[model samples]
Target: METKRFYQQRLDEWVEESRKQAYKGRVAEYIPGLAAAPQHALGIALWGTDGQFFQSGDTDLHFTMQSISKVFSLLLALMDSGEKSVFQKVGMEPTGDDFNSILKLELVDPGKPFNPFINAGAIVIASLIQGDGPDEKSERLLQFIRHLAHDNRLDYNEAVYESERETAHRNRSIAYYLKDNGVLEDDVEETLEVYFRQCSIVVNCKQLAHMALVLASDGVDPVTKQQVIPRRYVQIAKSFMVTCGMYNASGEFAIEVGLPAKSGVSGGILSVVPGKWGIGIIGPALNSKGNSVAGVQLLRHLSQDWDWSIF
Candidate 1:
């Protein structure tokens, strides 16, 4: 309980400190919906293996998951298609380019994506989720995320989804390229629909923390003690999160935070301190690498303070 009290006190101090970092970054404006968030806002929630839940600062603010959905979608793809099948469509290494870059597909031999977390790779994985159509796949992915969060009310932000769909010229090009290369399992538009809808799934820090707790426990629900995803698949997802989850800034984050963390362009990050805690953070202002500037700094401070490094 002393540790809990200490965490409470430190979180308040850290949140105030981190909030200042947000002013240095810009809110993502590629999609019209994301540009509407308050730039200086920062929030965080933590769910401990010991059943302690603590939250501070703007924790109730809702935002889309954005690229963070790739983690869960990759897990669902593995569950549906198995590792061999999933790996066949996407490579395991990280691409040093931007998450949506298409140049690597032409230069990187065999033409598969460098990893599942990137946009090109995620689109292929989206096609692998078993469904009769885009709507069904989107529903299945949402249900899986809801099951993890233990909140059936979780759903997509239609306005965001529509905005993403409308402005997805680069994503559309990637899908078409994948289709031309014969990597997509379904129609290009359909697969992109699933990808866009998943990215639009709205979440707050509390729900994100609960969902991340499943990954922290290695696919087991900490509260229910049930295996929600196979251990091996969770291992794969976490590995990807470590190496590629922060987009081009993953190596820097790994060196500083030293935990498996996936960040979204919407300024949301889902981090796992394996067997100890699940953390969720949101700060609408983003750094150049499409990650939350304030949220990333806060994680660095927490990781150093708690000595949570996996390395």
Candidate 2:
């Protein structure tokens, strides 16, 4: 009890300190909905392997998953199409460029995406998800996410979804390129609809932490103690999160925070402390590499203070 209390006290302090760092970054403006978010808002939620929970700051603030949805979509695609089929569409290496870069696709022969975490790879993964149509595919993925978070009522933020749909010209270009390369199996528009909807799934810090707990436990639902994702898929997902989840800053994040984590343009981060803890954070201000600036700083603080580094 004393230890929990002390940890909580320090966690609160860390959030306040980290909130000030939000000014150093900017909210994503390409998506009109995201641009309207509070530039300085910050929040965090942590769920321990043993069920302890700690949250502070803007815990109730809701935001889209953005790129963080790639993690779960990759897992779902792997489950739907199996390893061989999924790998045929995307490679396992990280591209050090921006997450939306298409230069590598043209540079690399056969045109497979370097990894599923990037925009191009995620579009392919979206097609790989088994469903009758875009709506079904999106619903199936959404159900999977809700199951992970143990929240049955979770749904999309339609405004953000529509905003992304209307303004995602670059994403459309990437999808069309994949279609031209024969890398995408589904209709380009259908696949992108599913992709955009998945990215717009709204979540708060507590729900994200709960979902991360399942991943932290290696695909086991922490509350029910049931296997939601196979252990092998979880291992693959974590590997990607560590190596490429933070876009171009992944290397620096590994050295500093030393945890497997995925960050979204909505200023959300879902992180794992191996078998010990699951963490979720949101700070709309993004650094140059498109990660939540204050959220990264907060993770660095907690990881250093508690020696949470896996490496």
Can you write out model 2's per-residue Cα lDDT over 124-189, one digit (the tens) per residue?
999999999999999999999999988998899999999999998999999988888899867999
Which segments of candidate 1 are over 4 A away from where they belong?
Answer: none
* Residues 1-311 of candidate 1: C-alpha lDDT, one tens digit per residue: 89879989999999999999998899999999899999999999999888899999999999999999999999999999899999888999999899999999999764689899999999999999999999889999999999999999998899999999999999999999888888875899989999999999999999999988999998999878999899999999999999999999999999999999999999999999999899999999999999999999999999999899999
What candidate 2 gets wrong by more than 4 Å, as runs, is none
Error of 1 at 65 (Å): 0.5
Reference-based TM-score of each model: 0.99, 0.99
In model 1, residue pairs whose N, Cα or C atoms come closer than 3 Å (at least 3 residues apart or on different chains), thus clashing, are none
- Each candidate: RMSD: 0.8, 0.7
Q: Judged by lDDT against the true structure, how good is candidate 1?
A: 0.94
Provide the overall lDDT of each model, using Cα atoms, as 2-decimal numbers.
Answer: 0.94, 0.94
Global Cα lDDT for candidate 2: 0.94
